[model samples]
Target: MDTALQTKPCRFGDKNTSDIVICLKNREGIPKRFYSHSSVLINKSKYFANRLSHPGSNNCIDIYCSEVNYDHHVNLLRLLDLPTDSILDSFDSVKSAVGILQLAVFFQCEEIACCCIQYLEAVPWEDKEEELILKAVSKLGPKAMPILARIQPVDLAATKDVFISAVRIATSIAGPCPPFGNELKTSAQEQVEFMLGEDEDAPLVTADEEVKSVLRMGLSQIYSSFEKELSSLLLEPDLVSERAEEKILHSLCDLEWMCNILGKMDLMKDFVSNWAESSSNVLGVVENNKLDSFMWGLKIKLIEITAKVLEAVGYGNVILPTPIRLTLLKTWLPYIRKMKPLLDSKGSQETGFPYKMSEDLCQSIEGAMVTLVLALPSNDQADILADWMGAEQVRYPDLSEAFEVWCFRTKSAKRRLVEGLDGAGNATVSL
Candidate 1:
């Protein structure tokens, strides 16, 4: 130890060499001591400099005063005594840092807040939580507004309003407001006039350019485009006005095309798996009930996307083989089955949240899911439909709806009964 210490250099505030204690209170109001040095704390954090300036700031045991809970404050103080080069590398670290940042802002520690702001601008977040962090950072004064231009779509996926606000502030330009309702108002007379007139030379936009613009958009814009299109279709009395969520659906179509073109089905599978996990539920920035929206969870998006992609009759421009198509369908069953209660007539009445998809939406979604099932290769269709109610864990089968879907879509509904799932004759399959 003597030889190694003498041979190598040590950075500032190496561990265990402490002179003062930073005290944080536990839930029971007992003080816990975290080691720190006056020089490092004063130099790195201005709050510590002011707090330690007066001799009375310390208790009899060299414990400097603090009121923030030990859970949130310990890491912030500990970081001060460590080398500055250490980076927070995970999503949870960023989430915790956001909490600690509140403390930093409270104590007038501009330096610590600046570090966190920089970290947040560069990190990938939980998509739904970016607004909370951005809102907090905006209150920190003028120095932090530039981060809006740097916020990626992944950070603003669920909150494009925040992203657009940041862009407007950073660029100092106002864009046109989006009109109400999902569809664009169109005129056939104007289209004819424009097609025949000299305006043809006025920089006509190409399909390639249009698609590039869509691609450049972050997740927020893509989702908005999709959702808007979806609304337009749903609002129309004609159930077939157009495809729903085209931008998202096609952006994914483009991915599927690339995956097939490159022969990377395994990679696509892995990507969807990760996408499914991160987007499993619509979690809010600080909500504790993480899976509160299970019926309309992130998995719903996957299911809808799969239904869009699996249709051999659509203008997808890419044809996924039956097996590949089946993989996408199977991936979403576990998630959709979780919504079985909400799908059942008795269970649907029991739902608490009002925003649950309407009866029309439920029917539309079920119709699409059933269509995708029936579109499966003749041999795979029955198995695919049956798997929705069957999983490793034993739960009450909601084949009630699944059976209803089969009855609606197939001629063999009476012959192919959803029986023997629970090994009891009490398990009935009536459509």
Candidate 2:
């Protein structure tokens, strides 16, 4: 019997054994227990195997202890078991610190994760070893959620590229299906939104004189370039004669151009407020019969433009002025209420742009109205208007005094009837 253990030539400690082969052999019937004196050799085999199998494993601390030779593992584990204060003062490298973090997180190490996150947060973005930081974060999982939440938009803006790079590293370490995946997704979206000027309703800078000066200079240059074309468009005789929808569309284009030229200035709030004040003056020029029709569509377009501008500026709660809001309510809503019957009566094919246009106009108007109402001061008039319009009063109960004034201005117009009367002496309305 050949009892002289016919073992395969063991390159047990050889770094050139190709880590994959070591792992495969370890899995192929290695005894679970070995002599204490042989632990050094046994552990080296296991370490080589694990490293080969998980080459991309980023958690250095975990990998170090589980895969290193027995004496090295004991030494590192002893260092990790030191008092928290001492551990803070003495770590050889980020890799070693990260290893400790991995061990802590794997064992539900709350205090360890907390301390690591604090240290990692304080590390300068440029100086910190990104791979080690990401590995620590990946292992922290939901424990990292609060730390992530505390990251300020301003800080993120400064280190955006670095942050994105770290995010990719962390995702790779945590694997494709991470437990805290949604948290990462939310953070990414928020960062993008912030960068695109979606975090606030006002412009990025308000009182910065340098920014304002540059803005004014840019606006003057743009106005100089496009003034002639814009004037020609406005002065064309066909503008007044065109269908109200066409005219309103052109006006919307003009507004967009103005917004662009101003470099979408922070002063947009003031500009829009002033524009709203002047809308009544513009409305005065149209003939009475055409005025209602023109305003009906114009108000809807105005609302759409308001929403677009507000969204662009990042002011989620900015409202159109009361005059514009009233114009929408009095001119557009009643028309839509009347037109709904016509839309129902005619088959979809027979309903031309007038019907389809009116529906789109109403939807945009309603959307703007909701936005405006949300920003108004809480009051009875706002409540009444919201309720009359069949809006949910609880969500937006406030109505500004400006809106009330608008309601007063448009009250007679909304209630007015045409000359001809039915048997009840009320004017026969058309869709």
lDDT of 1: 0.47
lDDT of 1 by residue, 248-349 (tens): 344444333322311211223333332333332222211223324332333244444443333321222344556555665565455555544544543456
Which 10 consecutive residues of model 1 have the lowest summed lDDT?
Answer: 180-189
Q: What would the TM-score be for candidate 1 when compared with the true structure?
A: 0.33
- Model 2 lDDT, residue 84, Cα: 57
Which stretches of candidate 2 lie above 4 Å from their native place? 1-230, 234-268, 277-300, 306-431
- The sequence of per-residue lDDT tens digits that candidate 2 reaches over residues 293-388 is 433345444444544443432234335555455453444333334434434445364545343334454444455544554444445345646555
Candidate 1 local Cα displacement, residue 219, angstroms? 26
Top candidate, metric TM-score: 1
Model 1 CA deviation exceeding 4 Å by range: 1-16, 59-69, 87-92, 150-431
TM-score, predicted candidate 2 vs. hidden true structure? 0.30
